[model samples]
Target: MDIHFIKENIPLYVEAAGLTVRIALIGILCAFLVGLFCSMIRYLKVPILKGMVQGYIELSRNTPLLIQLYFLYFGLPKIGILFSSEQCAIIGLAFQGGSYMAEAFRSGLESVSKVQKDTGLSLGMTEKQVLQYVVLPQAISTSVPVFCANVIFLIKETSVFSAVALADLMFVTKDLIGIYYKTDEALWMLVIAYLLLLLPISILSSVLERKVRYAGFGNTSTVSGK
Candidate 1:
């Protein structure tokens, strides 16, 4: 199965895999931050902000990621918003992942009991203080597994960056296949690269889920009351 070609191209594969991981890592981090802010906005029920966040989540979730990438990479430059291919790819991935993450965290926030909010208020805490000190922490713990799974999905989705010639793992794999005509080997390497990136994330998510469950964070009975 073109073992010789695979051996010869090891360095290329490694470099491509590194780039893929780097892009995914950056995108996931950005997504998490953006998503957290968006979720908070939704939770606060701000007069205008909730609608904006909902629109953003709906727009991003409904569109094809490829179209989003093309718009970022091709369309933005016309308006003088210049970005490199890699930057465009990262932005697109972050925005896409952020939409999903917002929903995940929103669900977590919803799962938080009204009693917890009342408890914070009974302690003379402001709404902001209650959200920051009580709701967010509980929501974060509850959402850990979903966040991890979403991040893993983001890693896989980064393959789409190849379409923009971002020189990520999938891009390099395609180039290798074209050069060596070893489609099977190229695909196998791609699969292995994905496994390397995602397996640990999956395992970590499972561990975190078990920990959260055992810690009683997942139990409705643990919620505080005023």
Candidate 2:
């Protein structure tokens, strides 16, 4: 192991790590927004819209992300919808993550009691208002831990972006290995970088899950009082 070379390359690794974090953050944010909207369609139970959202989720989930990336980067350009490699990477990650997130949110929403919706309706709330004010808050709370897990997975999945020559952590690591022929060190660094990112998320998810549980208990108590 070339400790001196590894020390010399610290700045390069930092730059690559930053790019990886940026891409993952942007992709995860887009996925969360899109996924939340898709979950709402399922919650509303609108016939046509629900079907459309289901189709999107199924298609995105069933496909390999590599193929998705290729389609976005190569196929789209042929049809005049051009995108940069970074954009394609982010879009691919977002779509992939969004599909799973939709399922996670759907499961969370389904877990909420139907009585809650009924009570909202009885209180003169519109369907949309009920969903917005009552159901979604609880559903989101229940879903946060699962969504956090998805975020961790999505962070790891950013490695695939290297296929398109994006300068993310894995891509730069591969370049370094090729240049210096230190494959073992490069691989270990990649593993450590992923662990550093993912471990904190796992701990955060556990904490958030406990907080949500306590909040739910508090809400129940308040409702009983009134």
lDDT of 1 by residue, 166-203 (tens): 88888888887898788999899888888887898889
User: RMSDs, each prediction?
Assistant: 3.5, 4.4
Residue 196 in model 2: lDDT: 80
TM-score for predicted model 2 compared with the true structure: 0.91
**Candidate 2's residue-wise lDDT over 53-107, tens digit each?**
9999999999988899989998988889999999998899989999889887886
Clashes of 1: 0
* TM-score winner: 1
Q: What is the TM-score of each candidate against the true structure?
A: 0.92, 0.91
Task: Name model 2 segments beyond 4 Å from true.
Answer: 217-226
